[model samples]
Structures are given as C-alpha cells and as structure tokens.
Target: MKIQEKDGTIVDVFAIYWLENETLFLGLPKNYGGLISYKEKNVHVIDSTLNGEFNYFSTHINGIYHWALIKEALLDDIIERDEVAYNRFVEILKAEGRIDPDFY
Candidate 1:
C-alpha cells in the first residue's frame, strides 16, 4: 500500500494493525518511525490499483498522530525495539482479517 501525504509525498505502507478498541494503525516508517491512523477522515483510502494481479490500496495522509486520541502511549520504543516482530504482528493482523484484504 501507499500513503500520500498532503505535501504530495508518497511512502510505502508495510502493514495495518487494528487495536482492540477499533482504532486502526498503519505500520509505516516516518522520521520518528511509528504507526499512523485514519480517524477523523484526515487520512482516508483514495484508490486501489492492481500490479501483477496484486491489489494495493492508496490512502491520503492528512493528520499525523491521530492514534494519540485513542490512547496515551509511546509506540516508537516498541516499534524500534524489534522491527521484525512488528512486521510479523502486522502480517498476523492481515491473516486474521483485521486488515482489509483490499489494502494488500
């Protein structure tokens, strides 16, 4: 998946994580390296494209740390601690149907 910032910057999205409270988190790497959210419609799905039979979703980036609205915690420490585990967790979410397959 691709995330297009308001400044027209596009970045690759590694995975999507869904919290127990229904908060959606995107596994992406920014300068600080953490997750992003789609609350408030600031971030939203724009389009889906096919590449070699693989479908990927494109989302527009408008807000930065919307996840903070749901919980007060630092994810950078957890994310930076073990990237492999983080990525694997995302894969689990996808496999468990927490992440929409259309965004693959």
Candidate 2:
C-alpha cells in the first residue's frame, strides 16, 4: 500500500505487526525511545533506529503509537520514508488490531 505525506510523498507498506508481542517500557530511555506511530490492535512504533539501546522500538513512533510495541512489517529500506511505508504499516497494524483503538 502507499501512504501520502503532508508534503505529498508516497510510501510502501506491508501486512504484519513486526514486534507487537514484545514487552514495552513504561518510562525509561533505555526502552522508552518515544512514540513513533500508532496502528490498530494496540500495535505501536516505539523506535526503529537499530543503533541505540532501544533497537527493539519501531521507527514509526508518532502520536499514534505511544508506548505500544506493535508496529508494521516494514522492509529494511522503507524505514527512512516515514510517509510511505510507515503510515501504511500503521494502518495494517490498526486493521490487525495491533494499535490501540483509543489512540486516534
């Protein structure tokens, strides 16, 4: 799928919540990388840097994802295109019940 950015850019997406089953850190930088984005069914984008201690976090962290661990199954290359892969990934997560319904 393709997601559009506020600037009118498109992104790709998949049909899987990559790390929905992982335990989330309530309040700590080690695991609390900050919100990336939110999908459905409680799936979230925590951090996806793969460079910091919070590599487990998804890169999509937005107002949508808060502390939830659920996130989209983005291809390794799509991480940088937040609008394309990231948003679509979040939608898939939401449809699959990964993101919290109350988030939006």
Candidate 3:
C-alpha cells in the first residue's frame, strides 16, 4: 500500500522480518539491502554493514524506535513471517493511527 507521510512523502509499504533486539520504527528513514548498524542516526542510503544490520525504514512516529517500512527487496522476509494475511500490516498501521483507513 502507499502511505503519504505528513510531509507529503508517500511511499509504498510492505512488511519485513524484525531484526534482532533493537527497537523498531519512529526513527529516521534509511535504506539498506542487507544488515547494517541499528544505532539511531540520520541518513539515507542502502547500508552494507555486515556485522549487524537489516533492511529497515523508520515509521515516522514520535519515538526513537517503534515501526518500520517494508520494501520490495524484503518481500521474502515478510513471507517468511507467515502472516495470516498481507493486510495484517495495513491493519497495524491503521490501528496505530499512522495511515488513514482509506489510504490503503
């Protein structure tokens, strides 16, 4: 689904597997194809840190870590999670008041 951020930046959303113990979401948005540092930072690009990282994007929430945005490359991770239905992600967004119900 497409989510329009408060700043008018709408991006496609998908669900990916959660990385390790790090908190998720409400952080700066960054792009990465594989693992990278989970420490919070402000940057944009596909990170390639091998020791500790995973593909993730901030949920744009009001916290350091709370949510993440899924991308096309992480489809396998989403599927691997064995979600009951794809819309589960959408539901979570709606429940969290992140996206309007009609947006999806």
Candidate 4:
C-alpha cells in the first residue's frame, strides 16, 4: 500500500512484507544477487545533533516502526500500542461500538 504523509511527502516507495502481527518489514534489493546492504548511509551532516533524536527521527522512522508495532500487536493478539498513535484504530472501533464476532 502507498502511504502519503500528512504534509504529502512520500515516506516510502518500495516493496514491503506485512506480518500477521502487523509489523511491516522493508526489504532492500540484494546487491550483486547475494550482498545485502546492511549499513546505513549518511543523509545529512550536522555539526549538532537534531533535537530529541528519536522523536525527530521517529517522523521518518514511524512508517517502519508503526508497521512493526502492528505486527507485534497481531502476534500478541491484542490492540495495545495503537494507543500511542492517538489510539485511532481503537477510537474508530469504539465509536462504531461493535466487535465482529466472526473476526475474533
């Protein structure tokens, strides 16, 4: 699925693997047919670190982490961390107020 950020930036444009647990893993194409690029590349050069590294970093990282959290939720078979992201999924379900008996 293609996801556009709130500001309309293309966060991810590649292949993905979605797990039953809701975690989405991004796969980078292999180089030379067997070499996987494991190390990260430099995106910027800063004399000082960005404020709240993970918080700022999370904006970019969240796309990857969100899917991972969903995977964890699915594996644990519970909807917990969805709360972190403004509890959107739960709020929608609560407002709708009906659990599909067939789904569970």
Give the candidate number with the greatest TM-score: 1
lDDT of 4 by residue, 3-100 (tens): 33334432211212233334342221211111011211211111112111111113222333223225334312222222233233233323443222
Instruction: Compose the digit string of candidate 2's lDDT tens values, residues 6-103.
Output: 44433222222334454322211112222222233333333332221122343653121222233334543233444455455445546766444442
- Please give the RMSD to the true structure for each candidate, in Å: 11.4, 14.8, 12.4, 15.0
Model 4: lDDT equals 0.25
Better of 1 and 3 by lDDT: 1
The TM-score of predicted model 3 comes to: 0.28
Error of 3 at 100 (Å): 1.0
lDDT of 1 by residue, 1-104 (tens): 45566666554443344344443435343443345543323454443331112222333422233232123233444355455544554454456554455432
Per-residue error (Å), model 3, residue 48 = 21
Candidate 3 local lDDT, 39-81, one digit each (tens): 3232222422221123444443222222333432323343344
Please tell me which model should have the higher TM-score, number 1 or number 4.
1
- Candidate 1: RMSD over Cα atoms? 11.4
Q: With candidate 2 superimposed using the best TM-score fit, by how many Å does residue 87's alpha carbon deviate from the native?
A: 0.7
TM-score of each: 0.32, 0.27, 0.28, 0.19
lDDT of each: 0.41, 0.33, 0.34, 0.25
